[model samples]
Target: MLFDTHVHLNARQFFEDRDAVIQRAFDAGVSYMVVVGFDRETIPLAIEIAEQNETIYAAVGWHPVDAVDMTAEDLDWVEELAAHPKVVAIGEMGLDYHWDKSPKAIQKEVFRKQIRLAKKVNMPITIHNREATSDIIEILQQEDAKEVGGIMHCYNDAVDYVQACLDMNFYISLGGPVTFKNATMPKEVAASVPLDRLLVETDAPFLAPHPNRGKRNEPAYVKLVAEKIAELREMAFEEISEITTENAFTLFGIKRS
Candidate 1:
């Protein structure tokens, strides 16, 4: 079985076939998935999905792309939402300098607020970094984020900082990028990362892996992410599945029955 530690089922991209997409994921062996709530509208929608399905779970926080719009009241609302039994984490939040959707200062501020909120709520955080690795690491360090730990969602290639993230007690999650033949860095990082500290995600409705590249991604494709990691590490497919699924379970505090 597989556990996709990150995905966005609440996104409008799946409005018409969301249920079918979820069914495909379970059929594809994705036993669990974290449906992230990265905005006001999706936050409630995410929790709604989680509440309706045992395999689905929610992570609440504002995305850095919308950081400028985040406010103290919003943080308070997220903090409150974190109390839900189905809400497992506090973000898919971090910096995204790849785009200028929000200024760096606001992104950093929002990231920090959510980090503190995660600490306050005793839930792990899920990070999103895009061309903002340096600032993300710095802010994480400054916030002493190791205390709560989290997943570095959709890690592309940060081999040099793998140890740094590990030191902060983060599990490195690989996504579609790892499956791209041209993506040498992510392959290297996937091969080199310790299996115990590795996880797999789909980041659904985005970043679909090779073979399915350029198409809308789905949770079912997490198997491809795990398979790529296995190929990169030269390990058996089943072994990578077991190891990463366990890693996800541990990081997200999901208990096996």
Candidate 2:
């Protein structure tokens, strides 16, 4: 079995065939998944999806790219949802310098607020970093985020930053990029991250793996990610699947069912 630790079944792209996509994931041996919701529209849908499926869960947070739009009420709403039984973490939140829709300072402020919220609730966080690895690491350290460990979702940075994340109690999650022929950094990180602190995800409707690279990604494709990691580490595919599933369970505080 495999745990697709990060996914976005709530995204609009899946609206037409969400159920089928989910069925495919299970058919492909995906035992568990966490649907991440970063804004008002997606947050409720994420929890809704989780509520309908026993093994699916949700993560709620604000996206850094749209940092300018997050209001106090938004944070309050996210906090309220944090109490939901199926909601497991506090983010898909972090810095995203790739887009300039939101100023970097505002992004940092929103990121910090979400981290603080996670700590207040004693829940782990799932970060969304883009071209802001150093700032993300520095902020995590400054906030003492190790108190409630989190995930560096779809981490695509250099191995040099892995220790910084590990030191701050963050697991490194590799997505479709690891299977890309030219994605050297993710491959390096995949082979080097401590097995116990590694995870797999698809970030579906996005970054699909090699053979399916240009297509709409889905949770079912996380197996390809595990296969790539297993090949990179010279380990069996089943072993990678098992280890990553266990790692996801540990991080999200989910017990085997």
Q: What's the residue-level lDDT of 63 in candidate 2? A: 95
Candidate 2 Cα misplacement greater than 4 A, ranges: none
**Number of clashes in every candidate structure?**
0, 0
Task: Give the Cα lDDT of each candidate.
Answer: 0.91, 0.96
Q: Write the per-residue lDDT of candidate 2 for residues 73-187, one digit (tens) a residue.
A: 9999999999999999999899999999999999999999999999999999999999998999899999999999899999999999999999889999999999999999999
In terms of TM-score, how similar is model 2 to the real structure? 0.99
What does candidate 1's lDDT look like per residue over 1-257, in tens digits? 99988899999999999999999999999999999999889999999999999978999999999999888898999999998998999998999998897999989989998899899889999999999898899999999999999999989755998999999999899999999989878988998888899999999999999899999999999999888888878889999999988887888788974
lDDT of 2: 0.96
What TM-scores do the predictions have? 0.98, 0.99
Clashes of 2: 0
TM-score for predicted model 1 compared with the true structure: 0.98
